[model samples]
Target: METIVPNWPAPARVRALSTTRDGGLSQGAFAGLNLGAHVGDEAALVEANRGLLQQAAGIPGRLNWLNQVHGIAVHPVSNEYDGAPEADAACAHEAGLACIVMTADCLPVLLCDRAGTLVAAAHAGWRGLQNGVLEASIKAMGCKPAEILAWLGPAIGPSAFEVGGEVRDAFLAEQAEAVAAFIPSANEGKWLADIYQLARLRLARAGVSAVYGGEHCTFSDRERFYSYRRDGQTGRMASLIWLAE
Candidate 1:
């Protein structure tokens, strides 16, 4: 199982990895390490792929997965939680418990304090991004935003993420600087939005300056990623972060 580890300068005890669409029991549209349970793949196959992930990646303990709704809700995670909460972001201060988010095209932002005592993961689609999911995650960390380091995981990149004028207008309503992130697409009344740049702008406003890992283009990379825009019915990859026990 090939996993993309964040290349930032995190502390020794802090670990983060983004899974790809590779190395699993799933076949066809959901082939290769599909860890998401809600994407219509067979339950047993998803479970088996998760097992492969745990074994191959050596995750410290159980992952605290979220039932993401593409909203700005952020939850604190622990082993005692009953089930995945209805949230788009999760954080963990306790060791041995990972905070995870599943995504095919939506952006996953993984955060950790310099001390390695806190870790968080956020699922940010354009709506969540505009509505403050990353900000909510920074607030949940209980640390100064400047002290947090973020790694922007794989998502649909700028060139392929076409949107209507309303989508661009929504971001502009929040921050005028957002205009730079949108470029006129060939189609009239449409624009290609740069999800990575938009994320950076939001993080910058929230005071998270040390950001990394936003080079991936899920829509373009069919072999390594699962892009919902590229494949209507597809699997989901997981981006996870945790403090070592």
Candidate 2:
């Protein structure tokens, strides 16, 4: 199974990767490593693909998956947190506990402290970003923002993420500097947004300065990624992080 290992300055024990639409058991639009079970893929095929991911990635423990709602709700992963919780972000301080989130066009932010005592993954669509998912995830880490490192995973790039005026206005209402991240698109009253930069702005506000991995463009990379905007009925890829034992 093909996966994009996040290239960040995390500690050696922090393991994280974003899976691509490659190497799995599903067929058609959900073909090649479609790890999300709720995206309308057959239950059996999704389960089998998840197994393939576990075997290929060699995850140390069961992945703590989330039923993402594109909100800012942050779920803390531990022995007590069993089954998929309805949240957009997850964090874990325990070794071998994998915090996972599935996405296609939404940005996945993976985080860890400098000492590798904590790890987190967040699903940030435009709404989640505006609602402070990254901030909540950072808060859930139970570490000072300055001590945490973050990676902005694959998402719809600025060039491809066109949005209506309300989207731009909503962000600008929160922070005027957000205006810089939006450029007028071909469609009047619409703008192309740089979600990666917007996320960086939010993280910086919360005192997180060390960030990386915002170069991927899911909307443009059809062969490697599954874009919800590009393909209405597409698959979902998993972005996960965990602390090694």
Best by lDDT: 1
Once fitted onto the true fold, the runs of candidate 2 whose alpha carbons sit more than 4 angstroms away are none
Regions of model 1 farther than 4 Å from truth: none
The lDDT values for all models are 0.92, 0.91
Residue 97 of model 1, lDDT score:
81
- TM value for model 2: 0.98
Deviation in Å, model 2, residue 140 alpha carbon: 0.9
Please, what are the lDDT tens digits per residue for candidate 1 over residues 134-199?
999999999999999999999999999999999999999999999999999999999999999999
Pairs with steric clashes in candidate 1:
none
Q: Candidate 2: what lDDT?
A: 0.91
TM-score per candidate, chains pooled: 0.98, 0.98
lDDT of 2 by residue, 51-146 (tens): 888877787677677888989898988877677889999988888888888999999999999999999999999999998999999988999999
Could you tell me the lDDT of residue 162 within candidate 1?
A: 98
Deviation from truth (RMSD, Å), model 1: 0.9
